[model samples]
Target: MNIEWFLVLSALLFTVGLIGVIVRRNPVVILLCLELMLSAGALALLAFSRMLGNQDGQVFVLIVLVVAACEVVVGLGLVVAMYRRRLPLDVDEMKELKG
Candidate 1:
């Protein structure tokens, strides 16, 4: 629909994701929040691109998607590796690196 609507929706989702990132103690939830933030960013980019009838926004959105994908892969890999080695996924419980 309208660019404003898209932007507002994206802002709301991004805010929610930010809150999740800050309040959640689970690594998986943090990663999910990161994904949500990325999706909101992509949506905003696409909406602007459509409003302006330009390809730059689309290109940016594509790049953002690719980066998000890579982030998800790496983040999940790290989480799994940590779980295997640390025996737990709680952020507060991670004290191995505090030494």
Candidate 2:
């Protein structure tokens, strides 16, 4: 029931997500990690908002959720496109996407 507990959980989620993003090779897994990171941030924001007894952070968290949803849509679209093109799903081999 403490703000510190929420913050600690958020930090742990963020750390796990960071590690996943760094260690995973698959694009899908990377995207999932990125979502995890976003969720962690949103969780922290909600915690702070609750602690402060304000609506601002909740509004921002809503915006963040919208952005995260957009990111997932675009990311999955790209992944599907790549799969349709018979491209490798591995992030390392995605260097060809560089312009």
Candidate 3:
């Protein structure tokens, strides 16, 4: 029931997501990690909003969700396109997009 508990949970989620993003090489996995991070952020925002008793945090979370959705759509589209082209899915080897 305390805000600290929610904050701790959010921190844990964010840490896990950060580790996943750093340790994984697959593009899909990276995207998933990104989503996890975003969710963590949203959770923290909602928790704070609840603590403060306001609608602003809820509205921001909604916006974050929409942005996350758009990011997933574009990210997955790129991954699919890369797959179709028979390109390597490893993030380390993705040098063609450097331009």
Candidate 4:
């Protein structure tokens, strides 16, 4: 497989995720976009790590997975809390939680 193609694909995926994050107003959709971005980053890291014959990137992917899991758990917790308050899912309407 061509490494350049992998890199390009990852870039495109990340770009789409970023665009989604910026354009979407819903917190849940934004969280999904963040996950997409994270997966794209992991894909690029794994591809380069494979090209260089290194296991370090593979280990780093485990860390990314853990972080992503934590992010989802926390994000969902916030979303659920927001819902409990009978608030809209729109990000702009979440000002009450702000410090």
| Candidate 2 lDDT over residue span 16-81, tens digit each | 999999999998999999999999999999999999999999999999999999999999999999
Model 2 pairs in collision: none
TM-score of each: 0.90, 0.97, 0.98, 0.95
Candidate 3, lDDT over the whole model:
0.96
Per-residue alpha-carbon lDDT of candidate 4 for residues 41-94, written as tens digits (9 for 90 to 100): 999999999999999999998899899999999999989988998988898777
User: Backbone clash tally for model 3?
Assistant: 0
CA lDDT, candidate 4, residue 6: 85
Candidate 2 worst ten-residue window by lDDT: 88-97
Q: Write the per-residue lDDT of candidate 1 for residues 1-99, one digit (tens) a residue.
A: 568999999999999999999999998999999999999989988998899899999999889999999999998998989978856788898877586
Report lDDT (CA) for all predictions: 0.91, 0.96, 0.96, 0.93
Off by over 4 Å in 3: none
Total backbone collisions for each predicted model: 0, 0, 0, 0
lDDT of 4 at 25: 96
